[model samples]
Target chain A: AQTIHQWPVAEIKAVGSPLSLGCTIKGKSSPNLYWYWQATGGTLQQLFYSITVGQVESVVQLNLSASRPKDDQFILSTEKLLLSHSGFYLCAWTTNSDYTFGSGTRLLVI
Target chain B: AQSVTQPDARVTVSEGASLQLRCKYSSSVTPYLFWYVQYPRQGLQLLLKYYSGDPVVQGVNGFEAEFSKSNSSFHLRKASVHWSDSAVYFCAVSYRGSALGRLHFGAGTQLIVIP
Candidate 1:
């Protein structure tokens, strides 16, 4: 069985502070990773995706960047957080038609 | 460009009643269709997916959806509803061969089952 683990399930941060969210996939090797964001009552938006290590594609620019440092690890970070950046961030990986998502990280920027 | 539309933003149904959530899509070619359910404070879980063959596909929890190329729609249905079936349902679409292509999601329908 494959599992995706995301860190810091919930976070409360001051505006302009740096933020970093991490996700690690276990039992899957070289799987395609993706990042998605959803507002409190908005639709899910694809942020970024990576097919292999060290290469990532930006789908929607939200002042954020993603990196696949290792085959099993993907990181989403920003030098400074904005008030609008606060939302639910999800990490997912797909080997075929279906995608498996992480538990998600709820961010609140105060 | 591929996009999905879930008409009903919210739906309320009584337990044991039949349920149907409508979904439509816009694509140049046959797209990969998927239905996902998101429980509160949880990640999206795949309920079912359609690529080819059998227009009607069965999914987990007795949920099923029918794909219609003529209507460009894939509507989810359940013969009987349960209180536990309440959640946000999303309709997504992607190109056939581009598994890595980002999935275009609908705004989602919030289903509230009355017990």
Candidate 2:
């Protein structure tokens, strides 16, 4: 089975501060990677997806950017944060089969 | 374009009562359907998937979903739901013959089971 790990379970930052989130997948090579955002008790919205390294696609521009540095690692970063950017961010991996989601990081922008 | 619709935004039922959550999709070809459960503050977990096999498929925790091509629906059903079954359900669809498996998810239906 494939396992995905995400760092910094929770985060609180100021509006102008920079932010970064990390995700790593094990046991699956070159799998499809995705970024999603969700509010409390709300539905999930896809943010980005990457099929291979150095390639990323944006679904919704919440002033966040995604990058696939390595085959097993995906990173979400922003130079500055917005108050509306506060939400739960999730990382997932799929291989033409079922998807495995990370635990997710709860973000609060003050 | 492929999209999913979860008709009921919220559903409430008593324990031991039969449960059904409706999910409909719009696609031109035969779409691959999936049902997932998300516990409070947790990530989505796969409950079941329907591809080319039997129209009815069983999943973990006594959950089953049936696929209907004519209606373009994949409805989840359970004979008797438990309190533990209370969670948000998401319906996803993938393009037929799709090797990428990028899923388009529905807004999700919130299920509440009373004890």
Candidate 3:
């Protein structure tokens, strides 16, 4: 069975602080990875997606970037945080039909 | 561009009652449709999917959704609601054939099951 793991279940950061979120997928290789964000009461927005290692595509520009350094690793990061950046971040991977999502990371920016 | 719309922002139902959540989509081609459930502070879980063939698809927890090509709608239904069914439900659409294609999501409908 495949499993996804995300780091730092939750975080609270001040504005202007740097942030990084990581996801690792096991039992699958060369899977399509995606990053999604959702505000407290807003729709889920696709942030970025990667089909292979070292290549990523931006779906929506939220001033954030993603890197797929390895076959099973995906990272989302930003140099500085903004008040609007606070939300729930989700990591997902898809091979064919449906996507499998990780537990997710909750971020709060003050 | 492909898009999904979940009309009801919130819905309340008594436990053991029949329930339905509406969804609509706009796309140039026959797109893939899905319904996902998100527990509080958790990731979205696939409830059901519609690709081809049958218009009605069954999913986990006795949930099912029927696809209507003429109406451009895919609505989720459950025979009996439970208190544990309370959660936010999302409707999504994917146009591309490959897995790399991104899914467009709806604003989501919050389901509240009352005892």
Better of 1 and 2 by DockQ: 1
Per-residue lDDT for A11-57 in model 2, tens only? 99999999999999999988899998987667788899999999998
Query: What is the C-alpha lDDT profile of model 1 across B62-98, one tens digit per residue?
Result: 9999999999999999999999999999999988788
Each candidate: RMSD: 1.0, 1.5, 1.0
| Residues forming the 10-long window of minimal summed lDDT in candidate 3 chain A | A92-101
Please give, for residues A10-44, the per-residue lDDT of candidate 3 as tens digits.
99999999999999999997999999999888999
lDDT by residue (B1-115, candidate 3, tens digit) is 6788899999999999999999999986878999999999888899999999999999999999999999999999999999999999999988766556788899999999999
Candidate 1 differs from the real structure by a C-alpha RMSD in angstroms, to one decimal, of 1.0
Where does model 1 sit among the CAPRI classes?
A: high
Q: What does the interface RMSD come to for each candidate?
A: 1.1, 1.7, 1.0
DockQ of 1: 0.81
TM-score of chain A of 1: 0.98
Which ranges of candidate 3 are over 4 A from the true structure? none
**DockQ metric, candidate 3:** 0.81
TM-score of each: 0.97, 0.95, 0.98
Off by over 4 Å in 2: B97-100
